[model samples]
Target: MTAPEDAIRARRRLTNKLIAGREAQRLRPFFAADARLIPGGGGLILGADAIVDAFAQQFHAPGFVAYVRTPETVEVDAAGETAAETGRWTGNGQSGAYMAAWRKAAGQWIIESELFVTLA
Candidate 1:
């Protein structure tokens, strides 16, 4: 698949899982074991389990809804084995910006690292 196409698919996969409140399951299939998550105002969380646990906290928030903006610009590496996604998202009455790095694992794109910033 072309880089653009791959980016689209990766983004969709992420958003779908998030919307369905499947952060834990989502990581099982789409995150490296050593994945890292850095959320605004929070210390770094390493490992897929830790990352999922962190997101699960947000998932349980009352009336929390995740929204990943459409047409997110994803940049693909020349080898097509890695990509990066950056965009804005809103949930639980808070909006933020995020960037995630994805690496192909066993023929599927999986998140390797992520950095998020809350923008009020």
Candidate 2:
């Protein structure tokens, strides 16, 4: 598959892992060391470690099931080195939108930044 297609599939798998609460398997392998996260309501979280820690806390919330709905799409830059996945996600009785930016290196795509905005 093309890099962009790979990125799109990877994001879906990551979302499934998140929904299943498989943090160790889902995050460490897919997030860059300097990745940043902007989870809704929470300001900015910088660094992969910090983001992981914050998510660990979030996973404790009851009924937390992170998932993306249909109509999601990924856009790859002309250079093919960067891509963005935008879609709607729902979990913990709340639905929202998410945009995850990814960077490709050594034929692998890893999340470089992510932003989650709650709409409901």
Best by lDDT: 2
How do the residues 14-86 of candidate 1 rate in per-residue lDDT, one tens digit apiece? 6665656646556455668999888766689999888778667767877767645443668888988888888
| Top candidate (TM-score) | 2
- lDDT over C-alpha atoms for residue 24 of model 1: 52
Each candidate structure's TM-score, on Cα atoms with residue i matched to residue i, is 0.78, 0.82
lDDT of model 1, residue 37:
82
Model 1 / residue 114 / CA error / Å: 0.8
Residue-level lDDT for 19 in candidate 1: 56
lDDT by residue (1-120, candidate 2, tens digit) is 566766566656765666466464366657889999888776999998887787677777776565554327888899988887888877667778888888887878888988888899
lDDT of 2: 0.75
Clashing pairs in 2: none
- List the RMSD of every prediction in angstroms: 2.6, 2.3
Model 2 worst lDDT run, 10 consecutive residues: 62-71
